[model samples]
Target: MPMLYLNTRHTLPMIGLRVQHNTVDTPITQPRYEQETQQARAGRGFTQPKITIDSYPSRHSYGYTNNTDFARENLERGMSEVQKGTSKHTQMAWALAEDGPKAGRQVGIEFAKRDMEQRVTRQRTLVAAAIPDPVIQVDPGQTHGAPIPAKTTPIWHTEGKAQITYHRGSFETYLQQKGDIHSWTSEGKYDIYA
Candidate 1:
């Protein structure tokens, strides 16, 4: 014979189960909740979220410096002013009054010449900074082989079917050995298996 258990508190006996009821509701108390809510509704207690963004050049990006561009623009602008006889140097030279027109033209031309020289120097400096000289290594005691002449034919023209097949095989082998293929399924789940 097996024993039976019953919960007699309910009208129907509940076997292998217990029932609990929470009739009283507890109120949550937050500090200044009503005051803050009222102030928010009145547009008095809220501030817009602050967002900041920063930008920087990528490590692999290749470009000239801002100073180079500025130098070029400044040179052009100064030359234009000189041509228009509106440059400060030209005006100052004309103020001397002894040979106003000739003095002004001479000063303006000198200023334009100096600006061109500075612009060229800046461009050269930038080029130097961007490209470095290659380093060569030599073994003095080792016997050297005959120099190989550079090939004139393009690599694609020289490559045969066997070479292309070999390259494909090598690439496939590399992918099988080291590649991790990830994909997304139609069910919106990520799959790691290829």
Candidate 2:
């Protein structure tokens, strides 16, 4: 082998590094609205419904995702309730109320109970997060571990409210007394077909 030992490392070809790209599918679903867009519900899109929030409330930092979900759900429920009165499909409800349902007082009471049930469920499910234990030890021989702090998550509860006035007066007097219905502006308030 004498002095014929050449540097074999110098004869080897250099193999460069390689990079790869991963396949990804990003699907975006556009919002669906019968007569408006997301921005409209946000209070500033296409014809800006006058019944927008008079003031924007501050959002919680710790409960961002949760609160956002709650807000969306709350809004959806409210919109659904409103749609019951506005949507043409539900217009039959009014007609049905006329001929099908008897004892308007009892029917109203049942509706109130159902509304209460929904409200109760909504309130209870508002705060949904499980706190994980940082350190769980069987023996207390070493104080290097901090017992899991039982986290008390803050809850944003809704009072579930609706403005109602039971009057012994006529419908005309009632409407006149209640200048604004649905919290619309004075100029925006209007009467519905009786």
Off by over 4 Å in 2: 1-92, 95-105, 121-123, 126-194
Candidate 1: clashing pairs of residues: none
Per-residue CA lDDT of candidate 2, range 34-99, in tens?
A: 332222122222332233332112223244346667889789999997887576335446645764
The Cα RMSD in angstroms, rounded to one decimal, for candidate 2 relative to the true structure is 63.7
lDDT of each: 0.43, 0.44
Clashes of each: 0, 0
Q: CA shift at 135, candidate 1, in angstroms?
A: 33
For model 2, the local distance difference test gives 0.44
Which candidate's TM-score is highest? 2
